[model samples]
Target: MVDLRGIRHPLRPAGHGRLPAPPAVDRVRADGRRRQGLILGWRRRATVAVATVALLAVVGCGSTVSPTPGSSVTAPATSATASGAGPAPTCGPIPPVAPPSGLDQAGWWRDRTFYEVFVRSFADGDGDGIGDLKGLIGKLDYFNDNNVASQTDLGITALWLMPTFPSPSYHGYDVTDYRAVNPDYGSLDDLRELVKEAHRRGIAVILDLPLNHTSDEHPWFVGSKTGTGPYADWYRWSDAPQGNGWQPDGSRFYYAAFGADLPDLNLRNPDVTAEVTADAEFWLGTAGVDGFRLDAAKYLVEDGPTTENTPETHAWWRTFRSAVDAQVPRTLLLGEVWDLPKVSASYVPADLDLTFDFALDTGYVGAAQSGDAATLMRLMTNVTKLYPATSGFGAFLSNHDMNRVATQLDSDPGQLGVAADLLLTGPGVPFVYYGEEIGLTGAKPDERIRTPMRWDASSPAAGFSSGAPWESMSDDPPSLNVADESASNSSLLSRYRNLIHLRQLHPALSSGTWAPVASDSSSVVAALRVAPTETALVLTNVSTEPVSPTLSLESSPLCGRPAVFGAYGQTVTIGPELTAAGGFHDYRPVATLQPQSTVVILLGP
Candidate 1:
């Protein structure tokens, strides 16, 4: 171990005095082969855990840690204590880990709408007037009403609270203690009740798991610095503070790309692995959470923007999936994989399900906003070839992490009509963000993108809370809010509700495989979403004027059955109206697409 000037101080990890050895990080490189000779190829990353006094220093000293920027760290740092390591530690008879089984981690997450709530700024129950869990509890009904057209109508399937644990900052990413619940949010009892009540309502809950690093005040850092703590190996340390690790002590250290305050944990430490594994287990088994929406998944495998290309990252996910399944089965794991369809596909480890399709979200955003239907049609043509059919991707227009679709489409709501038509009619599970049905918009970086659900923008906290909202939004009547939309049969919200209900109306829309028929080649598209039992002819034209195209349906699994949609093109038989050559109308087109508009026709048995 590298020696440093001794600083006498007593410190220890916040929870256990000595952490259990962490699961091995070495396995990451093994599963995801690092290409040799590639610049910074992760395949060559050292597999050995670093042995250091820094973990000891951190746990003992009670010092604050601020990791340096752009730092790539190696986490497992403590030297393995020579044999006879005291009473062999107290944390129970945990079994050895095995490869993942294609089972669930936790239940209730599969078919739920995952609601993400920014805790510090959600709602305030007590006069203290801060949005807390209790406040959210008080307003559950509002959430329920928002899902009127969803599968259950009980609001979202799970509540993804930003971060409710104790930290110096408002957004609890810098965790001080894993077990401690922030009192401001509510007691641990409040969290338990939240889960209980949600479950009672057929809803599930998900929490932000920020295991990557911790706040500076963590006891492990302090105790390791001082002599009283024996758990320094709990966190990653460096041999020389100046190397890859960002160390203020000028002692070797380990760090992450996010920030130094959040020191990367040493997964190489078996104790670390056991602790996190147990934490996930406890949440799934004890806390009764539905599942997790993994954050920063792209950062784990190697240190870069493109994740799926590298195998190490996928291996890390596999480890998490396996560990979670062993504890609780039936859990849902949705990844935040922001990349092209090819790279994003890596995150779906066969059994590990659900990734957002960014190709359409970003590309469609660029095309539709310009009212270019031909471009949108061409992009979809490109999409059919980019991703795999069975991966089950999630198609969304907007989410808390990205720009609002309305804003992205430049507020020309007709674009939303076409976008929603494509969304509900596309080739994957569709997600509808809260308030998106009502048409929410915010300028870049203003966070209006994450505004509260506006049952009506006029209600108290827009019917979300009684206290002042943490963020302000742009005021627009007919263009914003749900109340007006619901009142007007033609409003965007009503249209969305209809679209959602429509998807359900035809099983073909939900379970079918997509096949391109024929397009006008420019501004109009007519394709088929066919299932074993149903065939849906989906059409959209995103332009300033309506243009019709005669779409034809001839082939599929039918091989010649005469079925049009609700099934495969090969399975379905062609009709007189839809021809292989010049489309319908006694051999003419149906109707030109509506200007900046769309239309979906259910053409089945």
Candidate 2:
């Protein structure tokens, strides 16, 4: 056997490479770096390490390591005629996503930590029972706070507010008027202030744009009842009961995807598309906002009654994407197409930049809860291959619609730690749910799944509201709140911040191309990637047992590199000539990766 401990490093870490960082960047890139070499690693493709990595790739990376959207089985490339070859979609040349502010919407996110704010549950400004934009404005510092954004020095780069449009419902997903702002959440000016404040802090803001369905009480529904106004076609009406789009009207009727209470807009109608596009444009064009978090993107233009994802629906998205790109070139377009991989990635070339990696979230959480670290390890390897090279993906543990991740895993903090590691360090953009940093938990209760944001752990009302408060912070207050967890590096908040900052410091983990490392058992997870500036190893022990894995650099770009990036658990020996032995033992930080933990260790420069 190749003995790692038996070998010796004849050269020091500094002796590895003389290549300096990119000559372009004025600021530091990633991997504990403030200023980094612009270009590093893999300058020459024809090398022993690269060749070996390709050979080991077959064993290290499994083609069967499927995704929730589609099993690892590669779907056959669809024919143009199959998707309906009408016209080679001609898109007008739109401005780039880079707005004059130099916000770097696309590149800016290459290394960013996303914070999800449920407005109604965040900070309360007016002492009213509900949370508002002003409340969020007050907590900008919390977001801008170094502890959360990792760049308190520079302020947050982006803020994703839960659905903020005018609505009668508590969560606000049931939009009443697209043009108006909810009075309960403050006025349009309030939203403008929040956006302005965030921008001044060098941050860009993204509001949740729910376009799937509208409240039954929405004015458009009332207008459609008479088949009048510029919105008659906005509501899907039915002359014949053909599919799910039919309902009883005065003489005839229409169908609403949701119950009769929610009338689905006919996105097939160009006017409807124009209006929705205009609404989004209003936020970016007039409000100076950065981008949008599109809700229920898959549900739009669904096939008949069932919520199926179809290529026609994809056509609708293409139209919408063309409009947005034209209006705000550098703006972010994040869709909530919480479903499959291929279907989701299809929206990319159409111009939809990113979407929720529900596939990874589901698979990651399942692995964590069951203590199957193997799945956690498979996550990065699978998605890194499936997702488009140019697209940005949002990684989150839990959000408003689903059960809190903690609730699913029996509230096990250790497992939660593993989940955080997967999202923050693994790949793509990392998003932290509103009260996630603080251990808040509560599922759908006619009450908001989004519990109010708690500023002080000990303060009564959890600093969310002076009024009796809309919901309870987890009953396990002492254990979950920020006060108890912030200082504890082991606490969720600290772990998230550490990973966030580390992600910012290391270029490899940030915007890096991933490669999985081959191990003896598929049970213990291990992988590698060539990050923006460095090479590193990512390891996670899904199970409780001490997993001693035989790791080889044959699958990663790390073999020949001198320096790498990552954090380890227990202890490991790095043998000269690149051999590792006695894989980390029980609970020993094989690279400081705590059992049921996520650890990224940098190896070469």
Candidate 3:
């Protein structure tokens, strides 16, 4: 058995409290990984009883047996939690929040959960070892079967495909032909089929449009090397290697912000901008995709001395956005602006529909790793202020670029689940990396982080392909694969599924207004997600030790009795009177939060 008792919280200070001893419950341990079992003994029985009573009280079932004022309504822990467990907690159904008035149907992406897929690493088709459009089409049901009641699929509403354009590299970040699909991935017809299938299953497909640069072998880049033809001025060139990002091309040099092989396009040129705009329209109007995830959005047009987020870059985006909007007004343009939240927010409401929250990504991982909630709380509040009310942002834990959340959190499934809870419940649209739901672990070296998906544990390629995979599978254990986790309800994958469906079911989570809930302890982070009609209180214990922090819902309009949901492991009591501190109602969550766990309490009738 994997002894989790010896595992220390990375951010826990010296002499910090440790988790209580495991209970005498049936422990389900996995091989070569942290223990995947909850130690429910006496606490499990008591929680079930309290939850049953609480449910009756919430539904007004005429049960006189009111739960004792401070009686805990503990929830079953994830497979990695070291606390009480039984079945998932039974809670009242969360009322759905109505969409805002005059909300465009094209903006449907705002409330949907997005899944990012590296098509080359997702699944192999045609027995070719390489993942193709056909392979992804075959797995459409895995993302969303369009049957929410089944609860078997990942419940993904949108898919952000990482570059399908023909490219010299396996990763396809550097595009060669914008019009054609990569031969390895299949034909253009195959892409159309994938989009059709995805739409049939209620999944929106968004292609990764790397318009900032193209492969050096691209005909345009090749022609530009000779400094003649329509493509000559399409790329930025210097007589002799200019400044940073300029690469040697024969005797002359060209600007390549990403790398030498990826030559940056001169987006300042109306011809180049018009060409990219046409390509985007082709995909949306012809290929029938829902949107495009614009790669390197901030570096589209760089001025001398200032390479990123230049005024010219914003102008380029506005022009591009207007062109795309004119062609297909429904198209969602999500940008990959890897910068601070302020810089990212500047692109939205005009330039792009949404940009990834790079700051929140780091803040979420940092909060989880450090067992502190202050940073994440501050970031969420800032996001509310920075972006316009009409704009949306993409919230995620980790994407294709950084270390996977499982690895970032030391492969602790409990902490991983906590991060998912925050992402799904916090605000804006949540994006899940392809293998993230299954706890796929990888760090750096690019290729490793983009390995084949582990569909099953029986084969060397982990059922990713019958043939040799282009890249090896991650080092995560065989048991951590999808096939095994899909069978276990308490698995990390299941936790993600539950959270996603919860977000889908409640508007408070998907499109709610965010506000920080003041908590007494640094180890616990609390926030309130308020919709027009409903409110959700999200509390997370980032530490290894259980905490029962007093939360202040100050100056808020929360009036009804709260119904508890998710992995909460304690009784919650609302103070009848408002506290003197800012005249805010004091909510004492009497129940102790299990280490590395989160709970959502829905308030409002």
The TM-score leader among the candidates is 3
lDDT leaderboard ranking: 3, 2, 1
Return the lDDT, model 2, position 540: 67
The count of backbone overlaps in candidate 1 is 90
RMSD of each: 23.6, 13.1, 12.5
Q: In model 1, which regions exceed 4 Å deviation?
A: 1-115, 119-129, 137-161, 220-231, 239-252, 301-310, 373-391, 444-448, 457-460, 473-479, 552-554, 558-589
Give the per-residue lDDT of model 1 (tens digit) for 1-605.
11111111111111121223222122224567421111111011111111100111111111233223332323322222212222221222212221111122222232233456776555567735356788778656544433322322323334667777788766677888777678778887798888777665545567777766677677765555442356576665556443444555344455544676776665556677677667767777767776766665565533333323366657666777888877666776776678887666566645356667788776566656665556656666666555555225667787767777877776676777767767766776666765666677755563566555555555456644566665654454533665566666566765665555444333345545676766543665556664433344566665667665554334432111111111111111223222222122221123344465444433321
Write down the worst ten-residue block by lDDT for model 2.
50-59
Query: TM-score for all predictions?
Result: 0.69, 0.77, 0.82
Query: Which candidate would rank higher by TM-score, 1 or 3?
Result: 3
Tally clashing residue pairs in candidate 3.
2
| lDDT values, one for every candidate | 0.52, 0.58, 0.70
- Give one digit per residue, the lDDT tens place, for model 2 in 300-400: 88565565567667778778877887877777788887767666655664547787788878877777778765665566666766675422577788888
Residue 546 displacement in candidate 1 (angstroms): 0.3
- Residue-by-residue lDDT tens digits, candidate 3, 1-605: 11112111111101111111111222224563323222211111111111100111111111122233353433322121112211222223222223321112567776688999999999888878899898999999888776523557777888999999888788899898899999999999999999888877767889999988999999998888888888889999988766888888777888998889998999889889888889888888778998889888888888886999999999888888888888778889899999888889988888988998888888888887787888778877888778754227898998888888888889887678778877877777899998999999999998888989999986758888998888888998888788898898778888787677656555557666677888888887787665543456677787878887876554443432223322223343432222222123345644566777776655532
